[model samples]
Target: MTAPETVVPTGKSGIYMPRRSLLMRIADMRAWLFLVVLIAFFEVWSRSAYGVSFILNTYNLQSISVFATAPLLLALGQTFVIISAGIDLSLGFVMGLASVIAAHVANYAALQLGLPPLAAMLVGMLTGIAMTIIPGLVNGWLIAHLKVPPFIGTLGMYGVARGAAYLFAGGMTISVSNSWYSTIGNGRVLGIPVLVILVAIACLIMHYLLSQTRFGQHTYAMGASQAAARRAGINVKKLTMKIYLLSGIMAGVAGVLYTGRFSAGAAQAGEPLLLDSIAAVVIGGASLFGGSGTILGTVAGALVIAVIQYGLVFINVEPFWQFIAVGTVIIISVLVDQTQRRFTGGRQVE
Candidate 1:
């Protein structure tokens, strides 16, 4: 084999390379840097405002993890939808609906059918999954077959699902007496909260699905250009349906967690999670315009939001002010995303 000749820049480029390289790397890492800086700022502020112990407290960190699990799961599912250039406004309500259905089913199985706790729990979970999947399928059909816009399709489902939740529970809470169901959310594994463990497992699975599968590749392709993806032999309709289905399934999982944690399924559960999940996804560097995101980034984003919320509460900030702070962060995140898109000629960052 012939030896390759060395090639070198011959002009001003050579002088510029070393200096520009560092700047380019920093620019590429802006999202991660922003998250780190935000966390550091919160830690410092918490120490100053409350006490060093507040910032260093293991209990507070654990509490943040607990609070973060629901939103984290919702955001993970939102990542899939948004990556495919779709949105799911109904997810929060779907979670509530699923929770109610699960709780009611579990209660009936345990009390009426005289089933064992584990068996009743399993039955409830399956029912919840199926309930959420129905909306997912309907949303998919509306968007893919009926040609409804994703936003309109999901928005309509939002109302439908929420209404169903209220109706199912008679605008009240459905309590489940099964201790085994509660264990799913409250029990610990090796000193870690089971809810946190579920979140970790979900992140790992989503990371694998998004980073290593042909489905993931198709998702990016579809988001980038649906027509082009179809031309390239991707099953755009089926893929769209599957994406929404997965989102619904995740919402169902969140419902199960909610029911387990509270020992009751309230019709209003997951209402706040809608915006929080979107904020997490956006803060994590996913463009609303779609086609780019990562599960790891989303997890970091959730932590950032959780830290801000926890820090605010620790410093005794009013809840309204905390909401404002979160809103501001979300706006800044969107601006940053837009700036990045502009700089990159509208191409999504991988």
Candidate 2:
């Protein structure tokens, strides 16, 4: 939270230096704080109610990580889009489309073409991911070239992707017999899930992109003010396209992983995850208005949701309460953002 200080002239030959107060520093780490608080709450609840430890249990930790994988992948892309002051409502359905496509293509490659299981699985994954580029391009065209609003453009694509997924799936779940694919989804290395490791690598790449690259700087500039960015010679349109395309690719990866994990593909594979992805971005300290967020924060936000979902189930709470809990956290995150913005006179701290 230690930003470049602005010094003002004082009448008595002294400089007046302005610095972020302790509260502002605390606000910057709000996502992590929320995560810690939730974990502590769950641990205490488990200890008191069931005479068991939550965090100390290895199974609970693994379960939470498993629960977090898909949504975290979806949210990683979302963090970028939101930072660019845009949203991708189509990601959920896009993921479903990829899942169905992967299953179908994998089946064909194996059963019809007589490909090896591993080869078929790889083909299916590559093909499924490639198909997502179509929607990504269309979304980019609509929003960037045609000047369609992000919300309307993405929402329209959402329906299109969903319908296509169902049609391609023949309104039924397609099963995959490839053990290799399933292993990618479920197998672990050194006691960590493969999916978790994949997501961690993705997170690092995204974090570097957002924090250390020129593209990241341009994204923030555009989100803060497109007109100003244009004036500064930033290609807002191109950036917009890249942002949405990236979002689609992320969703596609999530979908492929979903199919691998379940050993089946359904049109509704990602239906419930859309909300969780958005919630993770918001709760991770990203501003809905634009121009502020971090991949690390999104990770914390995803973990927060995962902990809530898994912890509730462990405690035998009704599943329906998970939505309420997530919604409440989102609201608090937004309120905190607003309050912090007001205190900073509408300036976003890096």
The best candidate by lDDT is: 2
Top candidate when judged by TM-score against the true structure: 2
Q: Output the lDDT of residue 10, model 1.
A: 62
Tell me the spans in candidate 1 whose CA falls farther than 4 Å from its real position. Answer: 1-31, 348-350
Q: Which residue pairs in model 2 clash with each other?
A: none
For 303-334, candidate 2 gives per-residue lDDT tens digits of 99999999899989998899899999999999
lDDT of 1 by residue, 167-193 (tens): 999989998888899998688888788
Q: lDDT score, residue 274, model 2?
A: 87
lDDT of 2 at 120: 94
